[model samples]
Target: INYYVITTFVFQSAIKLALFHTFWWMFSQNSHILFHEMMRKIKYARIAFGHVLFDDT
Candidate 1:
């Protein structure tokens, strides 16, 4: 009986850890993609603004 209880606890702990790691990894990847996209957009905007300012001057 004691052995069964221990096994059950271990199994639950492992599943919890795996789920947490998977969720964290996915969140980090998503954030990284968003950051890169935002950077690209900012760069494009900066170039466009510069062109407009130069044209007006």
Candidate 2:
């Protein structure tokens, strides 16, 4: 029983890792715009939250 559970968990983990890796590869290769947008949003959010201590304002 324990062996079966271990095997099942390992199999699912491998599948999830593979799927994530493939998706990341596709995103990295095809669309940099989404990545850039996410970064811009993060920057804005930091500024809004006052995480960035220095600003021209």
Candidate 3:
């Protein structure tokens, strides 16, 4: 009886862990893409600022 209970518990835990890992992976992927886009925008902003300053001079 204890063995059956333990097995059931383990199976449930495994399923939960798998779901959590999948969610974490998806969140990380989205954050990574957002970070890259932010970096690109910052790089473009810096270039624009430089051009504006130089053009003024």
Clashes of each: 0, 0, 0
Stretches > 4 Å off in candidate 2 = 30-57
Rate residue 34 of model 3 by lDDT.
59
Give lDDT per model, in order: 0.60, 0.57, 0.60
Which pairs in model 2 have colliding backbones? none
**Candidate 3 residue lDDT tens string, 1-57:** 575576557656655665565566557778776566556655765675465446633
Q: Where's the lowest-lDDT run of ten residues in candidate 2?
A: 48-57
Give the alpha carbon lDDT tens digit for every residue of 1-57 in model 1.
Answer: 575576557656655665565566557778776566556655765665466446533
Error of 1 at 48 (Å): 57
Order of candidate numbers by TM-score, starting with the best: 1, 2, 3
Over the stretch 1-57, how does candidate 2's per-residue lDDT look in tens digits?
Answer: 575576557656655665566567557765675566556655655564453234334
- Structure candidate 3, residue pairs in collision: none
